[model samples]
Target: MRTYSLDDVYATCKRRDSWWTVYFVDPVACRAALLVGNRTNITPNAITVFSLVLGMASAGCLAAGQLAAGAVLFYLSFMVDCVDGKIARLKGTGTPFGLWLDFMGDRIRELCCATGLAYGQYAATGNVDFIVLGVAVVVLDLFRYVNAPQMKRVRDAIREANAARTPPPPGPHEPLPHQSFSHSPVPHQLGALTVRSHPVAAQPSRPPRSRKSRRRLLRRFNKALARRRVRTHLISGIEFHAAVFVIAPLLGQAALIPVTSVISVLFVANEIFLIYRMWLFTRSYSAVPKPEKSREHAPIGGSPNV
Candidate 1:
C-alpha cells in the first residue's frame, strides 16, 4: 500500500537515466548503499568525497595517457553517484549539503573527464586542438555556473510575487492552532442555511489549456499537499543532458559548438523557468483555503464575492 504524490512522477522521470530494460536500475545498486547509510558511521558526503577521488584518479590516469584506466575510473564515478542518491532516498536522510555535493561532483567529473580526453589527445599527438577543447568545456561550464544563480533569483522573485497574490491559507499548516478560521451565522433569523464551495481544478488536462487558463488553475492547487522536491531532478537532468550531448562533442565540431552551446544554455534557462513555474505552483497551494473553509462560506447574495 504505497501512497504516491507529485514527487513520485518527477522521481520516475529522473530515475529513467539509470533504469534497465533488462534488469533493475542503479537504485538496485543503492540497496547496498542504503544498508551502509543506516549505520551510525557512513555518511553521504563521505561517499561523495570517495566518488571525487575515483574521478580525479581516473582523470589523472587519462591525462597521463592511460585510456582504459581513465574510462574505468570515469565509469566508477557515476556508479558512486548512483549509490549516494540511492542511499539518501532509501534511508530518508536527505541533506541539502549532500545533495549539493552530488550535483557538484557530477558536474566536476564531467569537466574533469573532458579535460582528461583533451590531455590524452594532446599528449599523444602533440596537437593543441584537444587542449583547446578542454578549455572550451571549462568556459561553457562557467557560463552555466553564472546562469544558475541568476535564474534562481528570478525564480525566487516569481515565487514571492505569486505568494503575494495568493492569500494565505485560513488554517494551520501543521497541527491546528488554538485560534482557527471559523464561520458565524449570516445574521438572518429566518433564512435558509447555505454553504459555498468554489471548485478548484486538478492538474493539466491533455487538450492543453490557454496560458491564462492554466496559470490561474495551477496557482490554486499547488500548496503544502505537494512540494516541488522533484524539480531539482528536472533542472539537474536538463543541465546534465545538455552538457553530455551538446557540450561534450565540441572537439572536432568547430562550427557546431557555438550553436549547440546556445541551445544547451537556453535549455538550462528553460529548466530554470520550469523551476519558477513549480515554485509558483507551490506558493499558490501553500495559500489555498481548506476544503471545509470553502464549504462553510457562502456568497451572501449569490453573486460570487471574495
Candidate 2:
C-alpha cells in the first residue's frame, strides 16, 4: 500500500495561487482527492465534467428557489473544481483541451447561476431590476472572459522576451539524486492536519529599471496592483460567484447578487486597463535591440585577440 505526505499533495498546487484557494478551499479538497486518486483510477477530466454537472444542477435548484440546496451544490462544485486541477497535475495528465474545457465550464456555470438567481429573486419578489442586474453580470463576465486571453498573451510575451534576454546558467553540473518512494504498513490519521510547503514563485529576469523608466507612474501603479496577494481573492470570478451565489444565498441575503455584478464590472475594467498598460509595455520593448555580452577592451571591427 502507498502512503502520501502533505508535501506530495501541495506539490501539485501553484506556488502563487488565489488566497481563498491557497488558504480555505484547495488544500482540503485536493488532499481528499489525492487520497481517493491513490486508490482509484478516476481521471481529472472526469472530475471537471462532474463539477460542471454539479454547477448546472445548482443553477437548476436556484431557479427552482431551493436556495439551501443550490448553495450547497454550488460550493460542492467549486470544491470539485479545485480537485480536478490538482488531480491533473498529480497524474501528469493535464492537457490544453482540458484547460479550455475547464474554463468554458466555468463561464457556463457563471452565466447560468447568475441568471438563475436573478430569475429566482424576480419570481419571489416580482422585481424587474433583478433581470437587468443578471444581464449586466453576464455581459461583464463575458467581457472579462474575452480580455483574459489577451492579458495572458501579453504576460507570456513579456516572459518570453525576458527569457531570451537572460543568460542561461552554467551547466555540466552533477546529476540530481534519485528520489525514493516509501509505503507504510499502518494506516495514518486523515483530514484536518495542515502541512505547509514553501515553493519559490517564478519571476522574469529583467534588466534593472532606470529612474526615468521607473517614473512611468501608471505602469508602476498597475504593477503594484498586479502583485497584491488579496486581489485575486476579492475580484476573481470564482470567488465572486462563490460569495454571491453560494454564501450570500446561504445566509438568506440574495440582495447581494447585484453588488457582485457591480464588482464584476470593476474587475473587468481593471483587467482592461492592465491589458492596455501591458500592450504599451510590450510595444516599448519591441523597438529595443537585444543585449549581447561583449569582451572587455575588444577593438572595434577586429577580433578580441587583435
Candidate 3:
C-alpha cells in the first residue's frame, strides 16, 4: 500500500446524492426522495421515465401552440430531471443504465423542444421567422453532438489528474500467510500464513508494494477517470438544453428577443469553454501512462463514470 494513492472524490460526490445538494435547498428534497426510494424499489431509470413523459407532454403542448403552457411544462420537465437523480442517489439505485438514460433524456429534450417548436410555429402560419431560426437550431445540435466525445475525453483526463492529486484511504485487507516458519528448534519445512490487514501494523504493510495502499490508490484513480467522463457529458448536454431553451422561444417571444438572443450568444461561448475543458481532460488523461495500468476513471463534476 503506497502513500501516494488517491481518494475517490467522485464517490464522495455520489454519496452526497441529491441533484442539487451542492446548491442547497435540496437536503429536504433528498431526504424525501430517499424515504420514498427506500420504501419502493424505484430505480433512477424509473424516475427518468417519469421525466420523459412530462417532457413529451410539454413538447406536445408546445406543438399545439400553447407557448405559456409549454413553458410551464418545460420548467416541470427540468424539475423532474433534477428530482430523479437525487432520488436515485438517496435510494442507492444509481446504475450505469440509469445514468445513460438521464444523459440521453437531456439531449432528447433539447432536440424535441427546438424541433417541435419549429414544427408548431410552421404548422400555424408557415412563418419565415421559424424557417430562418431552424438553421440555427440544426447547426447548434450538430456542434453539440459532435463535440460531446472530445469534451468527455478531456473530463476523464481531469478526474484522473485530480484523483492522483488527492490520495484515498488505505485498504484494510490482510496479507497472505507466509509459506513457512523455519526458525523452529527442529527446523521444519512446514510454513504458516502471515496475519493480514485486520491489524495492519502486524500485517507487514506492502507500500506501492503495500497491498492496502495500492488498492486504495487504484480505486481513487479509477474514480477520478470516471468523474472526468460524467462531467464532460453533463456540461455539453446542458449547453444543448440552454441553447434550444433560449433561442427557440426567441422566435415567438418577440418582446424578449434581445434577451434571448444574448443568451444564445452565451451558449456559443459556453460551447467554446466546454471544448476547452475537454481539451484539459484529454491532456490530463493522456498524461497518465497505459490505460490498463492507470487508476480508476472518475466522472466530471465529482460524479463517477457510468
- On lDDT, who's better, 1 or 3? 3
lDDT (10s digit) by residue, model 1, range 177-262 = 33322353333234574433333779776554688688677665443213422232333443443343323433333422354455
Best by lDDT: 2
Candidate 3 structure quality by residue, lDDT tens digits, 63-175:
78776667666656766676677666544568888889998897677667777666776788777676555556667777877777767765766686667866465456743
Ranking by TM-score: 2, 3, 1
Full-model lDDT for every candidate = 0.57, 0.73, 0.58
Supply every candidate's count of residue pairs whose N, Cα or C atoms clash at under 3 angstroms. 3, 0, 46
lDDT comparing candidate 2 with the true structure: 0.73
Error of 1 at 182 (Å): 28
User: Ten residues in a row with the worst lDDT in model 3?
Assistant: 1-10
Question: Residue 225: error of model 2 in Å?
Answer: 12
Q: In candidate 3, how many Å is residue 252 off?
A: 6.0
In candidate 2, which residue pairs get closer than 3 Å at backbone N, Cα or C atoms, i.e. clash? none
Model 1 scores what on Cα lDDT?
A: 0.57
